[model samples]
Target: MQLDSGAVAEGRVTRVTDFGAFIQFDNGETGLVHISQIAHSFVRNIHDHVHEGDTVDVKVLGRDERGRLDLSIKELLEEPEEIPRPRAIGRQSPQFEAKLRSFMRDAKERTTAGGKKPTTPTKRKK
Candidate 1:
């Protein structure tokens, strides 16, 4: 079977390495799925994701200069939804902005007063 770029196929993992996994298709064609292509998220260990003899579906990313097939399992898997990030301090809510402004005003007032920080009143010995 001619495997073209973007083609999807089922293959059995022939070997697993620290960098990637080698898969052999039914047609006897072998491909390497790089660690980065094994999952959508960070893969600290390739063995944690795939092992020898495991059947996985992969997409043909294309061929290397040496005619080695470059495959990707993540391309065949569903992409994870992006998690929303908290707004930056500059883009904080109106309430937060008000609080910040009040604090800044207070600090500016203290600095301008005498460059001295406020001291708590201490009790004198009786």
Candidate 2:
């Protein structure tokens, strides 16, 4: 299959590394869901959300110069803002679990916790 940017597909994780997981699509194309792209929140451990041989749906984010496909599990997930929940002033509600989960997941992505550094702003080209 010709994987394009923004294309979404289902695949089984073929391998896992400190940096990411390799997903093999039914189409025989394998893509890497980088640790950074694994979730919307910080990701401390990739295994927490995905494991080898696990089937998962992912969104195609882009392709690296080497032709490796960059995938995202979070993109396939519903945005926190879109979910309905109860609001509590200066407090967290059990209903906020969905958003909380996302935050915790992304929290693991912190470099201090062994994940990649957050995206840095790039200088505009002249």
Candidate 3:
């Protein structure tokens, strides 16, 4: 059977390596599923996901520069929902605003004064 980009196929994991796993279809076509393509989340170890002789469904991402088929198991799995980031401090709380105002007032007072702006302490010669 001819496989094209984006085609989904079931294959057996023939070998596992540090970087990826090799899968062989029934028709004798073999492809590689890279570690990054094995899951939606970070994959620290490819062995944790697939082992030799395991059957997995993978999508054909495309061919590599070497003309080997590049596959992805992540494409067949549902993507994880994005987690919302925390709101910025200035926008989130009145306490933060009050602190910012106090800091700015202090800075303005220090600057308007005849004293020079605060400077880092100098090192003394031994």
Candidate of highest lDDT: 1
Per-residue CA lDDT of candidate 2, range 1-126, in tens?
667998888899999999999999877888888897777667878889888889999999998999888898888887675544446468578779889898887877665456556677999999
- Candidate 3 weakest ten by summed lDDT: 83-92
What is the RMSD of candidate 3?
A: 7.4
Q: How many clashes show up per model?
A: 0, 10, 0
Write down the TM-score for model 2: 0.60
Model 3 pairs in collision:
none
Candidate ordering by TM-score (highest first): 1, 3, 2
Compared with the true structure, the alpha-carbon lDDT of candidate 1 equals 0.91
Residue-wise lDDT of candidate 3 within 38-108, one digit each (tens)? 98877878889999999999999999888899999998988879733545555658888899999999989
lDDT of 1 by residue, 9-101 (tens): 999999999999999999998999999899888888998999999999899999999999999999988888973354555678999889999
Candidate 1 wrongly placed segments (more than 4 Å): 83-126
| Alpha carbon lDDT of each predicted model | 0.91, 0.84, 0.90
**Superior by lDDT: candidate 2 or candidate 3:** 3
lDDT score for candidate 3 against the true structure: 0.90
Model 1 TM-score? Answer: 0.64
Better of 1 and 2 by lDDT: 1
* TM, every model: 0.64, 0.60, 0.64
